[model samples]
Target: MLRCPNCNTHDIGRVGTNQFYCWGCFIELTVNDGKISSIHQVEEDGSLSSLNDLFLGDGEQDSISL
Candidate 1:
């Protein structure tokens, strides 16, 4: 069970090998080395926008999900 970093909810769906979609906040997360290295938002047009600056913590030091 993975927890969403944005909404802190354990409602994540695996969309790729290391990518996950957070239903809680509708954000996409990329996991590397057990940490969230990238953040993106799924837009209405099905485009992805970077949300790194807003939700990214110490990527290597912070664990955002399972």
Candidate 2:
């Protein structure tokens, strides 16, 4: 099970390959090489804002190893 970096919620929904959606914070999660690399929040304008820095502990280094 994957955990949401933003809300620390384990309620993540798989949306695609290496991609997940966080129901807790409604953020888009993108995993790479078994690690979470990017986090985007869906804006009211239907745009995405990068929230990776806010969620990731060590930015790109917090990714999981496969």
Candidate 3:
């Protein structure tokens, strides 16, 4: 029951063992130790643009539902 951190949608799919993709906002979220360690946005050309700086401002951790 993992949800997207950005869109807060339940439309998340597993792209890897610990990698998840959000169809709602087209963002990739990687979870490690129950916390979001990486966040990337899917570009039009299928490239990943790091959105971590925008969401992860300061030294704080964001947890996603698993």
Candidate 4:
């Protein structure tokens, strides 16, 4: 089970082929090659705000098993 990096919850829902939405923290997670490539916060206006800097470190993506 994939847990949200922000909330550490398993309440993740698939929004796309590799995109997932975290119900726990309301963040969006994008996966590539079985790793979390990007993370974004869904704004009230439905815009995506990058949260990669806060989660990923120095351009490094976090690894996760699908």
For each candidate in turn, the TM-score is: 0.83, 0.77, 0.89, 0.94
Best-matching candidate per TM-score: 4
lDDT of each: 0.82, 0.77, 0.87, 0.93
Query: Model 1, range 1-66, lDDT digits (tens) per residue?
Result: 577767878888999998999888899988888878898999999999998877765544356436
Clashing pairs in 4: none
On TM-score, the stronger of 1 and 3 is 3
lDDT of 3 at 30: 85
lDDT per residue for candidate 2 within 1-66, as digits (tens), equals 677766887888888988788788889878888877788998878799988667665644565532
In candidate 2, where is summed lDDT lowest over 10 consecutive residues?
Answer: 57-66
Q: Residue 61 in model 1: shift from native, Å?
A: 5.0
Per-residue CA lDDT of candidate 4, range 7-60, in tens?
999999999999999998899999999899999999999999999889998888
* Model 3 residue 45 lDDT score: 100
Q: How big is the RMSD of model 2?
A: 2.4
Write down the worst ten-residue block by lDDT for model 3. Answer: 56-65
Between prediction 2 and prediction 3, which has the larger TM-score? 3
lDDT of 3 by residue, 1-66 (tens): 777878888998899988999999999988898888889999999999998898877956687667
